[model samples]
Target: MDEKRLIEQKIFNDTSTYNDIMNVPYHQSKRHLPMNQLDRAFQFAPFGALEGFNDLIQEKTELYERKKYTTSETELTIERQLKYLQAHSLKVDVNYFNDESGYYEHFKGYLKSLDWKKGRADFDELSVAILNIRSIKLIKK
Candidate 1:
């Protein structure tokens, strides 16, 4: 196994050790610690907060992984399609291209004009359509 994989596996297998490493004295000492009853409350407060933050991080990591996989697949599909299009001397839609500011402004206008639910549905549909088109073109080639 690779070093990164090995380290991740170790962390997973020994969660206590991972927690201990993360909770090193120097790090803990840097934080503000309360006194008496307030200390207990503060300590428990951070535990709950940290748990919530960890959950959010895990969720974001999963999302990032999914997006990365999708992006890589889409890029490969687009590259294959471009090659095929070149070979066949087919014209590509130039309307897809827009300057960064123009694209952002379009979306900003879209957000301002549409209802939240409708805009979200449209976004999902467009995303799926783009991915499907690229995937299909790649498979065809």
Candidate 2:
């Protein structure tokens, strides 16, 4: 009677149109195994497009959490300890702020040299600015 009814009768109610396909049985391969729903879902799941991006983000967040403001007293104490360690050539554990990354880094090594004029402390493994030093202690053997 109406356009909607006409289209529905011609398409949906047309049993002969789908009868041939409906009667056909599903085909299963003899060699290949069927995939489970979980495995099939994983095939279309989203993945990380940029490698190492997660690690970089995690490192940044950890740095932010570890960063702290240093006081003048703390700097003065570290400087004093550095001078003593340099004079005695003692093995030490040091914590210093890295300006580039805005995080504190630890070093456990002998103090190789200290330049008061240049304001830097040279360790067996690395050199750090004196002003950036947060704390320093002798590594007891």
Candidate 3:
């Protein structure tokens, strides 16, 4: 009836079973696993518990977003700055927006050419859309 007695009786009943199991000597497995500590750890590692959840959070919490539209005054300012860039043709840091992701990103380098036809400013191995241009400031060397 008491918890102590109940446990004592159960232990007494299982004593033979425990003795049978304990009587045997510990035996090594015939085939040994080749798993290292790192591999064993990897097996229990957390994996894709919420796949794409982190990416979704990152997208929502992005540092910058593209403007809905550029103002007329801002457009004029950019045009003047671009002209200066063309005349000087100096290595500059360009801040621009990505149309696809609607996020602002920047790079520092020399312009390969200003592609007016394609509406993209081309750099060595990189190009950004003209419409997405935010600000271009000359990087003084």
Candidate 4:
């Protein structure tokens, strides 16, 4: 036979060699156990690097939609309330806009002092900028 035919005949007719390779058993670990269903499932699980991304998006969305307390009517009302508090030295609750975070925060205590010239108000221990004031209300008496 020619060289090509002889090589093909030798390779294709090696059925015993293929049979031996197929019958060989896979190697098993001595100490390590085979993966269970849960462990095997984890191997194919998807991975993400940006954790808490959903929460961050939700926080930003809420911040963007938040209402401001700066309308002219609201400003006038708060100014009147502030004057009343200062004149009476009233114990009041105050909700003021926090410019740094663009949100409202509250303080309920005695009105210690008012500095209209400086545009600031002093509570029991806290000094707040008057321009930041949103609402003021007399508490009990």
Candidate with the greatest TM-score versus the true structure: 2
Q: For every candidate structure, what is the RMSD over all alpha carbons to the true structure, in angstroms?
A: 16.5, 11.8, 12.5, 14.6
Q: Per the 3 Å backbone cut-off, how many clashing residue pairs does candidate 4 have?
A: 0
What's the lDDT for residue 5 in model 4? 94
TM-score of each candidate structure, all chains considered together: 0.22, 0.49, 0.48, 0.46
Candidate with more favorable, higher TM-score: 1 or 2: 2
True-structure lDDT of candidate 2: 0.81
Which candidate has the highest lDDT of all? 2
Deviation from native of the Cα of residue 7 in model 1, angstroms? 43
Total clashes in model 3, counting residue pairs 3 or more apart in sequence or in different chains: 0
Residue pairs in clash, model 1: none
lDDT of 1: 0.40
The digit string of per-residue lDDT tens for model 3 on 1-141 reads 999999999987767657767778877677996678987887787883677899977875563443556788877887777666777668877888875566777888877777677877786666887777778787877
What is the C-alpha RMSD, rounded to one decimal, of candidate 3? 12.5
Q: lDDT per residue, candidate 1, 1-141, as tens digits?
A: 899999998877876756757866654555766367976787778556565787777765654442322477665765465445445543233112122212211111010111324311122113222332223221122
Q: lDDT per model, in order? A: 0.40, 0.81, 0.75, 0.78
**Residue 125 local lDDT, model 1:** 19
Off by over 4 Å in 2: 1-67
Question: Who is ahead in TM-score, 1 or 4?
Answer: 4
Q: Which 10 successive residues of model 4 have the least lDDT summed?
A: 60-69
lDDT for 91 in candidate 1 is: 26
